[model samples]
Target: MNESMEAGMEQYLTAGAAGAVAGLGVAVPLGAVGVLVLQQAMRDRRAGAAAGAAVAVVDAGYAALATAVGPLVAAALAGVEAWVRLVAALVLAVIAALGLLASRRPAPAGTTGTAGTETAAPARVFVRFAALTFVNPTTALYFAALTTAQGDTLRGGAAGAVFTFGVFAASLLWQQTLVVAGGFAGPRLPDRARVWTFRAGYGLVAGYAVTVALPLPAL
Candidate 1:
């Protein structure tokens, strides 16, 4: 999948092989998210605490959009998210690299999370997703474009809105929780384990990029 310019993100935005079910695939990145939460917690205990709940809120919005607009819209506009993702892999790698580098940066003695303020994970993972999903420029606008593409499908008005909300609730809750759990598990890891996890995670992400670059089916 070639990365589209909708929101500057392309690679990981595709739905699952199961159509709407594919939306849940977003949860798989919890490993990387774990690293972020762990580091954020160590820096600012508060940010880490509230991270999860915030994420759920962000996810709910995306879920709503995904449902109201319909995946078909995104599919039609982008045409094969796998291809779009393939291109976006490079962009994702850049983001991941930035995160890894920032992760390595030493915080000041009193600094906490990246934002300086911290909170416990929200009541649920979906809350975190709902709050944080749009923090990324790509996902935000891309989803909007997909929504616009719906046209008649969106005319269902409240019904469409409700459907979108249901889809979002279902998809985001399932996906965002992965990040919450990852944050909670971070501190328990040993130094060596954490390092290796980073190495392996980046390596796998890199490998995935290579695969995406190839003309293979956009899995």
Candidate 2:
């Protein structure tokens, strides 16, 4: 029994390492969502950290689903991809509009409010990030492909759980790094520069949303 348990533990560790690699592979790409995460970090490290956590949570959830029932999840996602993209695009547009409006507002008094006007509630940040991440069907598809390619080695039971945990951990680490870097750089920028950066970020996000909504050829 002890030997069997030890072997299982070893398998879980191996699966976990694989999951970590997969997580980093997906998270390292500086997409619109990633840029927004950096923007959040620039405003407040805590908010950025929360956004990072939310991203990890969504990634882990997708990883877990893929590990458990990859083919089924993939099929479901394929069926709903169009609708999901539409919803995601609309949500991003709304967010972008809000950001643009906020950026145009005059700065309050003498203080340089790097944190901006958005509430820094971790829960709100987490939910926002999670919703943003979840709407992208590609994330789910990516997890499904990764898990399916790995075969049975990383599928189901304790091994799957460990793998999902690893994904969450690695993603969280990457996000934290972004948050820290953004926080470090945000305070140094002049008010005008910061405002312009915010506008640029909003425009980029809006562009990404429109791109997602369109049926463009995948790069």
Candidate 3:
């Protein structure tokens, strides 16, 4: 019995490490979401931290769900993938437009410091980031694919739980790193440079949205 328990623990740890790798694989890509996180961090460290946490929360939730019911969810979403992609693209475009508009606005009076021109409340920032992350079905689809591919390792129960926990922990670590890095660099940048960064970030997001909205060629 002791030997069996030890083997089970070993399996759990192995599965967890695999999950962390999968999480990092998905999170390391610096896309629209990454740019938004960095922009928020540059504006206000608190908001940046909140945004990062929110993204991590969504990622963790999606990872858990994918591990738990990946096959069923993927099957269900397969039929409507195009529509979901379109909706996600539209949402991203709107967010990019809003960010561009916000960037163009002048900083308010009496707001002096490296805090930048943060107009949104912390709670609002968290919710907005969370919602934006959730709307991108690709995150869920990526997890589902990973879970489906790792059938043997993620055979449910304690191993699955440990794997999910590892994914969440890894994602949080990556996001917090981005937040910290952005916060550190933000203060050093001049106001004009910051504005250009915002514009560039928003423009990139719009480009990403357009790419998502475009149809893929048949294989």
lDDT scores in order: 0.46, 0.83, 0.83
Model 2, stretches more than 4 Å misplaced?
Answer: 1-6, 77-80, 107-112, 115-119, 216-219
- List residue ranges in candidate 1 displaced over 4 A: 1-63, 66-83, 110-155, 175-180, 202-204, 211-213, 216-219
Error of 1 at 23 (Å): 6.1
Model 3 per-residue lDDT at 25:
82
Model 3, residue 57: what's the lDDT?
Answer: 86
User: Worst 10-residue stretch by lDDT in candidate 3?
Assistant: 111-120
Q: How close is candidate 1 to the true structure, as a TM-score?
A: 0.49
Task: Report the C-alpha displacement of residue 30, candidate 2, in angstroms.
Answer: 1.1
Tell me the tens digit of each residue's lDDT in model 1 across 1-219.
Answer: 344554322211332222234234443345444444444444334554455435444544564565565455555756565555555566546655654564464445554333322333444433443333444434544445555564554434553554344445545465335445555655666544555555555555455556544664444
Clashes of each: 41, 0, 0
Off by over 4 Å in 3: 112-116, 216-219
